[model samples]
Target chain A: MRKILLASLLIPALALGGAGCSGKKDAGESGTQLGGTVHIDGSSTVFPITEAVGEEFQMLHRGVRVTVGISGTGGGFKKFCSGETDINDASRPIKEKEALLAAEHGIGFIEIPVAFDGISVVVNPANDWVDHLTVAELHQIWMPDSPVKTWRDVRPAWPDREIKLYGPDVDSGTFDYFTETINGESQVSRPDYTASADDNVLVTGVAGDRDALGYFGYAYYAENTDRLKVVPIDGGGGPVTASHTTINNGTYAPLSRPLFLYVSTKGGERPEVREFVKFYLQNAATLAAEVGYVGLPARAYELGWQRFESGKTGSIFNTDKARSGLSIVELLSL
Target chain B: MTAGEWRGVPNLARRHWQSLWLRRLFQALTWLGVMLLAILLFRIARQGAVWLDWDFLTSFPSRFPARAGIKSALAGTLWLIGLTALISVPVGVAAAVYLEEFSRAGRLKTFIEVNIANLAGVPSIVYGILGLAIFVRGIGLGRSVLAGALTMSLLILPVIIIAAREAIKAVPQSLRQGAMALGATRWLTVRHHVLPGALPGIMTGVILALSRAIGETAPLIMIGALSYVAFVPEGPMDGFTALPIQIFNWTARPQQEFHGLAAGGIIVLLAVLLLMNAAAVAVRHRFQRRR
Candidate 1:
């Protein structure tokens, strides 16, 4: 009976296997309408905002194919510089190396600051001793070869227990921004820790262990406030917790940074891409707030629209290296 | 009288029709299953076929769906399976051998047997949590290749032992008796005859178990495997990513192109599974011929 069953199962599978041997072309062209594929890929931090825009934009322009991908900021820039994507979502401004690569590929892009994001340091809800962390303390905990091992090591009054660290993986813009701003260098944090590109994993990791400490986008912390405690940061002006008021007013200090969408000059020339960018800017402030990011101020939005309208090319951060810990005002002046 | 009673005519047409219906039902069910598999294979192939090239296999994962490759993930999977096999095979086989040959049945034995059976039925993700606590935290192995392999080894150990035990049970009792009767010690007789006879079955089980381990993404995820690993693991202690995790990451991305890449990753995984099963069948066939 088992042999019969086996043979009966195998025969049809073999037949289907033979049928599957052939292939088909993915012809995406649709007959006569405003239609073209607009590919967007970038930081998962920026993913929620782009996805909201992409969905609403698609609803209005049914003929256009808008796709969004979360490849982390660095990975997105890699694709953007290679001319593979129409728009690149970034949690931070484009780095000097990324701009150089884009120039090398002759891929001129316009950078539009879309929103403000705060990277929130968090610990388990059970962690009561850590009300806030100083920048020097963050450096002590995360800087390469630092001596901070236990909770007691961070402060003299805390309990003695191993500090289980979790953070974004190297691919993440969050990791880059955090290390750059706090440790005063990019990708220079200590190698020992639990890391994931997905923020939820880190959230779960930190939430599960009492001694666990981690950081991710402020939106994630806000969403998981019940399970995790967001740590206030003292940037030499007393501890300031991440909030809409603090993040929007730029009082969130070094952790508060602008999010962006880089549009290719060639792509913007296309009617679909041009219309989409216009729609994106008009709705960014509204959608940004809806997605838990601070909408850029009215003036910043105007400047962004102006920049896009003028076909502004090259990055405002035109240097050949990452400029860390810069405020939105400083970036705007530059 | 008895002969006459037994000679009553069989219900020929009824029996024939009943058998025919049963056979048709089986065929229909089989085809239904086959249709589902065919649809899945067809969709994956159509989506990913264009992207399945040498570069896709060899290149490191990039943010650009087109530039992203599975080099790190592919290498990590091979390393995971290799290390898992090394750890589980010896331990699983030994446990099976001791349970089958070394001891008499008792409450202790019964308890172990029932627990092993239950362990086989536990969800894979639960094992991931266990590994995170025991290996990643308790043992401080971190989320390295060694840690993942150890976790996977535990996940598949019960299945391997159960398979090994069944294989060992099938070895003829007389063969062991014959070897012992010829002045061989009990250990020698079991080792030389029983173990040799069960080798093919045990090997088949181990390979199939390893294949299942390779396809697993949950426990690895729970233990904090990186979603994007740029470099291949150089040592067992180094960080790594597997094919399933990479596929999951790509599919989770909002981009249509990465969805295609995820499909491509699935195709590669299916191919690896098929290869392992083929090897198991070949080994079984070779052993059957020798017997």
Candidate 2:
């Protein structure tokens, strides 16, 4: 009886899988039409915004389905350059080699800024006296071999308490940016911070501990304001709090960054693609702010549109490489 | 016999064309399939190969993505496999031995047999949800390594049990009768003879299950194996990451070096997978030699 049942069940399943194997080629072509499923993957950091946009975008254009996957920035880029996705939401700029791979695979792309952000430093709301910290102090706290293990060690007036930390995981772009700014390199930090890809965990961690400090994308701090304390960084002369005014004025001190969305140029000529991108940039200022991050200036969007139309982006931004612009000291204001 | 003498028809000689054509077609199709598979593996190997290195394997993930390593993740995966083997091997083998050797062929047993088949066919993701509920939340294990291991054990139980039963059932019934005729107890015959012969196949099944568990991401992720860990877990209660988790994390970055790193991580994973399969083959061959 078991033998008969096994034979009856297994034969059809194997046949079906074998028959359906031929359908993979036709899957990518019909994707431009309405009601089609646009499978988007990558960037957990950018997921909320894209998901929010995808949700409303799908509703506005009925029959069109958008599925967003959070695979992280570089992971997303591989998929994007492989032509597996329409738009790649990235937390950082594409590297030169990634562009080369895309080109090798016939994946032409355009980079557009969706919004601005101030990568906020946060702490548990109970840490009262740590309203401001110097950039050097941040270096001391996060550097590989620092003697400061406790809040008391950081400052004599502060409590002699163990300093707990919660931050983005090693894979996070936020961590990348913070490490670059604070350590003058990427991923050089004391291995004491409890890390997670989900910002919510960091929020909860800091919120639950009075002595704990955390850092993540600015939007997270803004959304979970009641739970965490946003710390001000003293660039050099004055301690600057993170705000729309401060971030816009470029005084947020080392935490301010531009958010980007990379779209394949092969599909960029399509009307739906153009319209979608236009909608994204036009609404980015409002939508990004609504999602608790700073928006880029109106002119920034205008310039982006002009560049897209003209088919020229400044060659520097077009390719990723270290240019002879300035030193870290020169680029960042003290 | 001559073809003409056998067939009694002139056209019989020409029928060889049809036979030749069919054989040629089958051979061509088989080679084509093999070639396509080779191409796919080559592409995957090329992509994942660049990321494999001692530095990549040993280091913790960095903001740069490519510099990230799988030290903690490797440790965590090994631990998960160890715990899973501890729980699953005995339960699966015992259930198989009972159903195949001792249990009376009855309606109740038949019903149990059908349910096991059904369980084997259920999607892996469903097992993930079951693991989340039963082991993680129901048992209140709280996203620990133990919780992840328990979920994996459940996922592979049906497959292991089915494989074990098949191995046990394949043994000639004459051997069982011979042992029984010599005044050997039912338990002793099963223990000494049936088990040794079945051990090879059962081990193969368990090894395959372990290999599948190593590559599994969804259930592990659902059970709270987060994307980053600088330190290897010291116990089942500690937070952990796995090799796939690290690979997935690195591959998600847009950095060139990171993509390279991800490719390297894939190479390492494939190597681990291949080595385990090789070990399984060696074990199976050893058992066959004894038989």
The residue-level lDDT of candidate 1 at B265 comes to 97
Q: Compared with the true structure, what per-residue lDDT tens digits does model 2 show for residues A109-128?
A: 77776666788898887788
Give lDDT: candidate 1, residue B160: 100
Q: How does candidate 2 score on lDDT?
A: 0.72
Which stretches of candidate 2 lie above 4 Å from their native place? A1-39, A313-334, B1-291
Task: Kindly list the per-residue Cα lDDT of model 1 for residues B1-291, writing each as its tens digit.
Answer: 233354464665666779999999999999999999999999999999988999999987765677778998898887788778778988999999999999789999999999999999999999998997898778988667889999999999999999999999999999988998899997897788988899888987887788889999889877656555555665677667899988987775535577799999999999988877787788778767887
Worst 10 residues of 1 chain A by lDDT: A19-28
Q: Which stretches of candidate 1 lie over 4 Å from their true place?
A: A1-33, A318-330, B1-291
Clashing residue pairs for model 1: A68-B254, A68-B255
Candidate 1's residue-wise lDDT over A1-334, tens digit each? 2244345434644654543232111122433345665777777678767766776787687656565555567767887897867889888788789998999999999988889888999999988899899999999999999798999999999999999999998878788889988898878999999999767778889989999999988877876788889999999899999998899887888788788899999888887898889898899988888767888777777778778888888777534332555555456545
State TM-scores per candidate. Answer: 0.52, 0.52
Model 2: fraction of the reference interface contacts it also forms: 0.00
True-vs-predicted CA distance for residue A89, candidate 1, Å? 1.7
